[model samples]
Target: MKTCLVVDDSGVVRKVARRILEDLSFSVREAADGQAALVCCEEFMPDGILLDWNMPVMEGLEFLLELRKRDGGDVPRVIFCTTNNDIEHIAKAIASGANEYIMKPFDSDILREKLEEVGLIEKVDP
Candidate 1:
């Protein structure tokens, strides 16, 4: 199963993401902040990451920069998942190496679309 790291300060957000990713057949790992996410990454190389913007300890942008600085071949593709939907914030998240961005309070279909966009899901036979 593909592994996914979910980094968010909110426990509910983490649980929701974990459930969604697991439903898509991904093995989900969770962190409350960027610091914990880094540790999780070192321990296990995840195929993808879902990061939150406003977190305690280390924020999402800082985490992305740190991940880039590390010399590792198995760097996970990242998606910034947060409530912040400002144009500038979106640009910054993409600039910081996020492959995609997801607005919060997303429905199941939206979440599935994100997974498909990242090649984690395939289209079903009609």
Candidate 2:
């Protein structure tokens, strides 16, 4: 199964994302912040990452920059999951190497669609 890391400060957000990712057949891992997520990546690179914008320790953009610098880091499909919906934030995320972006309060379908859009998953029947 493909592996996914869900990085968020909120336990509830992490739990919800874990469930959706699990349903999509991804082996999921959770991290409370970008620093922790980076540590997790160092141990074993995941196939994809669902990252939040704001958190303690390191922020998502900083982590993305650092992650892209590592060997094999370019391979993971990164999707920024956050409440930041402004064009500037979205543009920055895309430019920083995120494969896609999803707003907060996402449901399984929205998450699944974003994954599909990024070519991380095959299309599923309704």
Candidate 3:
């Protein structure tokens, strides 16, 4: 199964995302902040990352920059999942090397679609 790291400060968001990711057949891991997510990546680099924009220590963009510099970091399909919907933020994310972006208040379908778009998951006949 493909691995995924879900980085969000909110416990509720993490829990919801975990359920959705697992349902999609990914082996999921969770981190409450970008700092922790980096540590997790050090031990096990996942195939994809669902990252939040704001956190207590280390925002998503900062982590993305750092992660991209690390060895094997470029392998993961990084998707910025955030409440920031502005064009500036979107452009910044793409410029920083994110494969895709998803706004908050997302559901399983949205998440699945983004994952598929990034080629992290394959589509099935429905």
Candidate 4:
């Protein structure tokens, strides 16, 4: 199964995302913040990452920059999932190497769509 890391400060968000990702056929893992996420990545690089902004210890942007610098880091399809929906934030995320972006309060369909757009999952008919 494809592996994914869900990085978020909120337990509820992590749990929800975990279920959604699992339903999409990914082996899911969780990290409370970017620092913890980096440690997880170092141990084993996941096939994809569902990241959040405004996290403690290290923000999503910072973590993405650092991750891109690491060996094999470029392989993960990173999708930034956050409440920051402004053009600046979205542009910054894409420029920093995120494959796609998802707004907060997203559903399984939205997540699946973004994952497909990013090439992490195959497209499916509704």
- The residue pairs in collision within model 1 are none
C-alpha lDDT (0 to 100) for residue 38 of candidate 2? 91
How well is each residue in 6-116 modelled by candidate 3, as lDDT tens digits? 999999999999999999999999999999999999999999999999998999999999999999999999999999999999999999999999999999999999999
What root-mean-square deviation over C-alphas does model 4 reach?
A: 0.6
Which has the better lDDT: candidate 1, or candidate 3? 3
Per-residue lDDT tens digits for candidate 2, residues 1-126, read 999999999999999999888988899999999999999999999999999999999999999999999999999999999999999999999999999999998999899999999888998888
TM-scores for all candidates: the values are 0.93, 0.98, 0.98, 0.98
- Poorest 10 consecutive residues by lDDT, candidate 2: 17-26
Query: Which residue pairs clash in candidate 3?
Result: none
Point out where model 3 deviates above 4 Å.
Answer: none
User: Model 1 segments beyond 4 Å from truth?
Assistant: none
**How much is the lDDT of residue 92 in candidate 4?**
99
- Give the local distance difference test score of model 3: 0.96
Backbone clash pairs for candidate 4 read none
Best by lDDT: 3
Range of the 10 consecutive residues with the lowest summed lDDT in candidate 1: 68-77
- TM accuracy, model 2: 0.98
Is 1 or 4 the stronger prediction by lDDT?
Answer: 4
Per-model lDDT: 0.86, 0.95, 0.96, 0.95
